[model samples]
Target: MFFQTEFTHVIELFQLPFMQRALLGGILTGIMGGVLGSFTILRQLSFFCDALGHSALLGISLGYLLGLNPSLVLLPFAVIFALAVSYLLEHTRLWTDALLNIIYSSSLAIAIIILSFVGQYKGGLNNLLFGDILAVQQLDLVLSSLLLIVCTIYIGMTLRTQMLLTVDESLAIARGVSVSTQRTVFIVLLSLVVGISIKSIGVLLVSAFVVIPACAARLMSRTFTHYVLLSAGLGALSAVLGMVSSAWFNLPSGPSIVATQLAIFLTAMVIPRLRSVTHSPSTLPPQV
Candidate 1:
């Protein structure tokens, strides 16, 4: 019995490398998602992020077919797409949602066509579609970590300006905030974060990394600072838990992580509802 137990323990230990990478990646992703997501949520740009997520599929396919590093390739594409979209939004006066549809839908269709043409390899599209944490190399981990650090510092330094712009863009412009440049900078930073997180979350669901925890935290917190921190913590926790559970249960890490995040979001939603039910209505009359 002792030998059997030892054997099982050894088997578990064998998966540690994968788990370690996933945990580390998840932590960095959480920080990125949390900080950038706060901006995303505040700017009401979650749909833009979702569109960018789809745009990443184009970059991924192009990278694979061309034999380049997907993230590096995707970085430029994301930046270009972001810039183009920003320019269109600012100059053309077209609705932002309409622009997003034009960008994402076209990119996605192109990606599907390109990827389908590539000959199959083991786990071929799965890596780009769902992510493969076990495949993360030391270089990938280092790159992701560095990007996360940069994003954290950049966002931290500029958060006040971002907040001002988010609340009232015209007022921020009136106060000499350079709203256009700041908005441009913000989009670029978001692209970098999304580019870095693609290896772990994949092109398909990466926006969830930006949107889910932020939404969940919005339900639970009122202050911006608290909301950002809570969202980051929740994002990291969900990533770690999802990765571990996926490994243990032989599930897909990407979907599992997203599922866990959604569960947290649901819980947050329910708690407020439950509290509202249990607490009695105020006896005082409505404010005049």
Candidate 2:
């Protein structure tokens, strides 16, 4: 009875316009986060996304300084930053983690300096820092959906090359994949996704959305196909459930969703150990 009541309440929550938009945005962000995060984890670029999140503050500050919509200013700044980072990553020897840290720290410092002058340009700054899914707008939903579609199309068109590059860059190069271009395109897309998602997921936790679900999916995947599908599915599932959970408990949506994803990741971490122990020869019943 309790379960039925809760389920009914969840269904009823969707009747509200805000809830509907939040769910749609969550699903779209989930798919993008999962797919991109799989690639990010494989490439060990968790710091990269996290750093991009930090850098967004500078962009947000700039938007405030200019008295414009934050996302409008944020997208261009993020793309420019991505372009620069991609160039340096391809051309220089600096570690990606180290470079990203330097960039984000510098950006945060600059953002602070600017914020001091802008004088709380908008109250929405706090929301950008920590995210607010319930407050997500229709534009955010549309942008995230478009991101999902673009990512899907790009991956679909270049699946083989992407896989080869991820698994073996040398082999991909030998197979005629343009590694540089592919990397740049992927980085740009990552930036755009990060920029657009900041309003909904916040800079502090958006990377969690990208990294955690993919890591959970990675735990038991048997094949590349399984890995990709599982990661995306887990991401979408976590996002949807997280939003529902947040609404039910009146929790902060960003943190609640991330916590849910973290829980799933922990569960994934334990599952393999349990499976191994259960399947051990010593555990088999002798009478069988």
Candidate 3:
């Protein structure tokens, strides 16, 4: 009865406008993260997402300095950062990991230096670092929905080529897939995902949405199609679970969401092990 009552209360919380927006926005962003996150995991570009998330801080700092909404500044800044990173990787000889590492470090420093002067005005530093999902705005949801639509279309058009390139670039090239072009296209879409989501999930935890779900999906997926759908499902599931738990416990939504994903990861890991044990030949004595 107590659990039922608490569940009722949690459902009631969603009647608030802010909660409505958070749930809608979180689900959209979660779907995008899961979709691209699978490709990112395959391409070994998790750190690239880290660099983009960190670079968002620079844009947010600039927004504070300029008296603009941080999301406005974040959009262009993240898109440019993604393009520049892609260009550098294609044009230079530096290892992808090393280039991202330098950007990650430098961007963090630059953001801190700028924020130190203007951070007092943009509703405090905590919001940028940890996020405030209940404070989600209407515009944030609109922009997130638009980006999700664009990403879906882009994937529908290029999914096969993207997979081919990731699996073996030489084979992709022989098959007439333009590696550089596909990378550029995907990076641009991914930057928008990070930009729009940062407002709700924060830069520190934004990458988690894109990473953890797809990772957990990898353990149980039997085919590529299964992997893609399962990853997105896991992402959306985590967002909804996290939102309810956050409303119930008054916890930070971003951490709550990521924690749910972590729990899923643990469950995915253990289930495979349990299956192996259960299906193994019996070792116990056969009692008459």
Candidate 4:
């Protein structure tokens, strides 16, 4: 009776307009994260995405300093930054990690300095750093939905080419793929995704969305397609479970979702091992 009551209460909670919006926003973000995250993991650009997330503050700060809307500048600024990083990496001999670190640290410092001068912010910094999915408005949902569609169409068209490039640059080049151009395009897309997601997932935890689900799916998938699909499915599942838990327990939504993904990753890790142990010849009853 207690379990049924709890379940019914949770169902009723979702009937609220705010909860519905949060659910839609989270699902959109999750799907985009999973789709782009598969490539992020494949190309070992997890840190790149993380850097973009943190560096988004610079864009937000710039908006405040210039008396413009942060939302207006955020995506464009992220894209430019990503392009610059890509250009430098291609043309320079700097180590990828070192270059990214330089940019990440410097961007954060600059943003802080600018914010200090900007006097007051409409939304507190914690909201930017931690995110509040329950605060999602209709505009946020519409933007997220549109971005998801764009991301899906782009990924669908370039899936094969991107996969080949990820597997082997030399092979990709041999097959007439424009390696540099594709890389640039992907980085730009990643920047946009990470930039937009920072509003809901927060800069600190956004990378988890792109990394954890893919990592979990990797453990159980035999094919690349399976990995991609499972990662997206897991992402959506985590978001829903986390949102539900957040409402029930009155917890922070972003961290709740990230925690849920972490739990799923741990489960994925254990399941394969459990299967292996169960199928071991030693565990079999005389080959039965």
Which residue ranges in model 2 land beyond 4 Å of their true spot? 1-9, 283-288
**What's the distance in Å from true for residue 224, model 3?**
0.4
- Please list the C-alpha lDDT of all candidates, in the order they appear: 0.81, 0.86, 0.87, 0.88
After superposing candidate 1 on the true structure, give the runs of residues whose Cα lies further than 4 Å from its correct spot.
1-15, 120-123, 281-288
- Check candidate 1 and list the clashing pairs: none
Candidate no. 4 TM-score: 0.94
As a TM-score, model 3 comes out at 0.94
Off by over 4 Å in 3: 282-288
The predicted structure with the larger TM-score, 1 or 3, is: 3
| Residue 111 in candidate 4, Cα distance off native in Å | 0.9
Distance from true location, Cα of 52 in model 1, Å? 1.1
The superposed Cα distance between candidate 2 and the true structure at residue 260, in angstroms, equals 0.8
The candidate 4 region of ten consecutive residues with least summed lDDT is: 279-288
Model 2, span 156-228: residue lDDT tens: 7888888899989999999888888999899999999888888888988889878999999999698877888
**Local lDDT at 81 for model 1:** 82
lDDT of 4 by residue, 1-288 (tens): 987888888899899999999888888889889988988998899998888889998998999999999988999999998898888877889899899899889998898888888879744788878777888889888888888888888878888887898888999999999987888777887888888888898878989999999999999899988888888888889999999898778789999999999999999999999999888777546855
lDDT score of residue 22 within candidate 4: 89
CA error at residue 185 for candidate 2, angstroms: 0.9
